[model samples]
Target: MCGGEQGCIETVKAALQGGVACIQLRAPGWKKRRLLELANALLALTRPAKVPFLLDDEVDVALACGADGVHVGQRDLPVQTVRDLMGPGALIGLSASNSAQIQQADVAAADYLGVGPVFATQTKTDAAPVLSPEGLATLKALTEKPIVAIGGINHANIGVVAATGVSAAAVVSAICGQPNPLASTQQLAAAWQAGVK
Candidate 1:
């Protein structure tokens, strides 16, 4: 999701400064060399900040860049396969959109579960149906693994997301294309905190 009006690195730096808990690099169509370059640069920032950096669907690039791990979708590599490749120390994340997917997921292998399009999202053209806060809560009850709510999360609705007792929220457009990613991230973080309270 780089190559926006503002560069991805700068946006990441701002989000880190704004207290983003983790960073997932999710550039879908870029070439491997370019993806590796961005991953390395992002690692430079995330590593020093003690933030976990993850690549989306690019295990080779992640390994090359020494990223913390990779996030895989259902159609991507299997969770056990990813764990086997990344080994025990690497943090693996899996996306499961509904109860059936969640039940079928190999929770033992993944460090966490990314569940959503909790609302309508334009970020992913093929994103799942909207889960809403209630759907997220229902999905949460289905698994013991930490849930990171994804899709359509923004400052306006992040409070309800946080109030769902999810372990985290994965935001894209809210910060990525914004005028001030740092300020936007700060507001989202504050909203998440307020929602948690």
Candidate 2:
């Protein structure tokens, strides 16, 4: 789930109501105990809504919360390590910015790949180089694993990203920073639906 000044639990709830398929709680700077508290709170809402609750880059917090999954970056623990710690049933996502990284990842152990900076973004200060639409298409052509495009994803470019046949798109400010998250989520979701059709 996305976090915000308005609060992540509320942000996720509004997005879910607007038809978001999943939520990833991403508070990397938080302490483990605090992170666990937030993750559990997120799980409560996601569970009832039938939406998956994922933790960003913290396997321990994810396991402690019994989060449906965990999304890790390239520098984080390896996908196989996470899988071993998570066992075989939990969902595991790994980030890949380019073809080299994609070819190098332990894809067989991952359930999906978080592919992007589809556009330049300030959300993640250290985000990899922008993987323009063409880059995304190239990656898509090279893989059969599910891809969820992230970074600079908003209503403006969501359709283009979805057109690459990505299984999903992860957004932050587009929903969390908006004044009306529900409408924003609905618009993004609709754009994605239209793109896939």
Q: What TM-score, over all chains together, does every model reach?
A: 0.97, 0.95
- Which one wins on lDDT? 1
lDDT of each: 0.91, 0.87
Candidate 1 per-residue lDDT, tens place, 51-165, comes to: 9999999999988989999899999989899888898999999999999988884767899999999999999999989989999999999999999999999999999999999
Task: Check candidate 1 and list the clashing pairs.
Answer: 1-27
Query: lDDT at 124 for candidate 2?
Result: 89
Write the residue-wise lDDT of candidate 2 on 56-137 in tens digits.
8999988888998888888898999999998898889999998877888487799999998999988889989898988998
